[model samples]
Target: MAGAAATGGSARSDTYASARNWLLLPSWAVLCIFVLAPVAMMLVYSFLTKEFRGGVIWEFTLAAYDQFFFDRGLFGDEPARIDWTYILIFWRSIWQAGLATFLALLIGFPTAYFIATRPAQTRTVWVFLITIPYWVNLLIRTVSMKFLLRDQGPLNDFLLATGLIDDPVRIINTNAAVQIGLFYSYLPFMVLPIYASVERYNFALSEAAADLYASKWTTLRRIVIPSVRPGIIAGCILVFVPSLGAFLAPDLLGGAKNFMIGSLIEEQFKGNAGNWPFGAAASMILLTLVLVILMFLARQQARADREATS
Candidate 1:
């Protein structure tokens, strides 16, 4: 009778496992087809050349790559074109992303710290407030900033009325405006991970550090920071990668002159002179850059976790 009971239990376990596997198979298949297949297509497209009159040519060619790497036009002659628009866009995107990430971290750390330290019931309210705006559409939120930042907007009017300035500040149509947009847009992403990390943090670590005569600054540096490194990394990636490829915010809030990789890609896909091949190559480059950064982030997180365990 005992042997028969054990055999029945094993049969149930096998059935459950098989059922779970069946459930996951379709989702995995969808992911492979939609995500991996598109990525594979981009990789292939990156190697092809843009045809003079239209779409990508099937013939193998290195001209697009060569132009991307080595050639540069003279100043005033074709606007001193850099053949490697991909690299230039990459750098600019990263630069903007870096700034956005840094700002988000600075602002989010304090807010998350406060929220996480709150009582359980109060913490729920604070978290809701922080995330509520995120429910709004990204496009609507970005366009709303224009109304607030324009030369004749309320902000400028207030400054003028208060005698803060004789003229309106150039808050709109500049990199600064775009930066503001990026910060506002990505701030929630920065906060969520940090709040999660901070809430899980053991205050005893800092208390022990203090008992060792560590100054407040030193305690934060050595204890608080190291403990929350994972959250910081997650927040940075959340803010940076999105800001890097951000399109709507920059487009709606800043000047046409301030172009980013996302805008450039949009131009290729939908603007006056659509070049699908060039856009595909640019998309592939951006995707590769993201994958590389994520790899580094994963390694860093693993190392931190290992150190924490040790």
Candidate 2:
């Protein structure tokens, strides 16, 4: 009788496991269709020769990467020199994205703390209010920002009336504007992750730190930060990666003059430049750069985990 009961239980377990495996089919389908398929397309496109105008030829060549690394001059005949143009654009994108991440972290950490420290019932309302403005489309939000920061717009106009400066700040088509847009666009990504971390944090540990005579700053640096480091890292990654490829913010705010990697790639496919191979190459390069950074971070995290465990 006991053997019979065990056999029935094992059969039920196997049936449940089979059903669970079947349920994963849709998820795997979506991943292949949306993520893996597009990445594979980009990789293949990068090697193919660019057609006369916009498309790719079956012929494979390294000319796209060569163009990126070595400048063949305007007519494509001169001796190769290091192309600073694209290098500078890549550097600019990295710097701006890093700054945007920093700005989000700077503001996000405090905002998250404020919300997280609130009573459980009150926290929901705070989160809701914060997200209310973002309910509108991103395009509308960006355009609204442009209107507010334009030379004759409310921000500058208010400054002028109050005698804040001699001239309206040249912010409309500047890096500063790009930073602002990036921050506003992804602040919630930064905030929510940190809030999730902070919300789950053990406040008793904080109180214990206080009783042990640790200063607030010391407690934050030693206790709070280490505990929430994962969330902070997650938030920074979320903000930085998207800002790196942000076209709308740079295009609209920087007036297409301050070209980030995204704009540079966009121009190849959509703008006057019809070099599809070069665009694909640039994208693959960007993708590679992101992967390298993520790997480095993962290594660092692994090292930290080992140290903590040791």
Candidate 3:
């Protein structure tokens, strides 16, 4: 009788396993079809050659990547020289994204902390106000920035009327404008994650630090920051990754002068320059960068979890 019961239990377990696998099959199919398939196609396109006309050549070549790193001179006869233009644009994207992330963190942490410390009933109000800008489309928000920053726009007109400056400052089509736009656009992303972290934090630890005669800065640096490090990392990643591929703000605010990786890719895909293979290559590189960053963050989080448990 015991052997018969054990056999029945094993059969039931197998049935459950089969059911679970069947339930998961649809999701797996969607991922393979929608996500993996496109990525695989892009990877294949990146290795191919760009035709003189639109579309890619079937022949596989590394010319797309080669074009990114080297220029064979104007006539294609001289020795290969390193192209600093692409390198400069690449670094510009990195530093600008980093700067925007830093600025967002600077503002987001304080805002999130304030909201987190507020009465639970009123906390929702604060969050609602923070998210009001997101109600509008991103493209509209970016375009609205142009209207505000234009030479004859309200900002310049108000400054002129108030005697702040005799002349309208060149705010549009400049690096400063692009940075400001990026900070404004991605601030909410930073705030929301940090708020999530801060909301769950134990204020008792902060009070304990105060009782121990710790300075405010010391308490924040050592106690609050350590507790919310995951949120800060998440916010930074959320802001930085998107900022790297930002096209609208740079194009609308910075114009031709502030062409970024996103703009470069867009140009290759649809603009006057139609080099799809090179665009695919650039996209692959960006994907690799994002994946590496995510991997590093995952490792750090795992290590922190282990330490905390220990």
Please give each candidate's TM-score: 0.86, 0.91, 0.94
Q: What is the lDDT of residue 49 in candidate 1?
A: 71
Q: After superposition, which runs of candidate 2 have C-alpha atoms over 4 Å from their true positions?
A: 1-21, 300-310
| Residue-by-residue lDDT tens digits, candidate 3, 25-123 | 999999999999999998999999897666898999998888888999878788999988887888899888989999999999999999999999999
lDDT per residue as tens, model 2, 1-310: 9999999999999999999989999999999999999999999999999987799999989999998889988899999999988889999999999999999999999999899999999999989987887889988999999998899999998898899887997788998999999999999999998899899889898999999999999999998988777778888888999999988899889886789998999888985567999999999999999999888777766664565346
lDDT, each prediction: 0.86, 0.90, 0.91
Off by over 4 Å in 1: 1-21, 49-57, 72-86
lDDT tens string, model 1, 20-83? 9999999999999999898888777767877655577886765455455555454424433455
Tell how far residue 155 is off in model 2, in angstroms. 0.7
Error of 3 at 46 (Å): 0.6
Clashes of each: 0, 0, 0
Candidate number of the best TM-score: 3
Report the Cα lDDT for residue 136, model 3. Answer: 99
After TM-score superposition, what is the CA distance of residue 95 in candidate 3 from its true location, in Å? 0.7
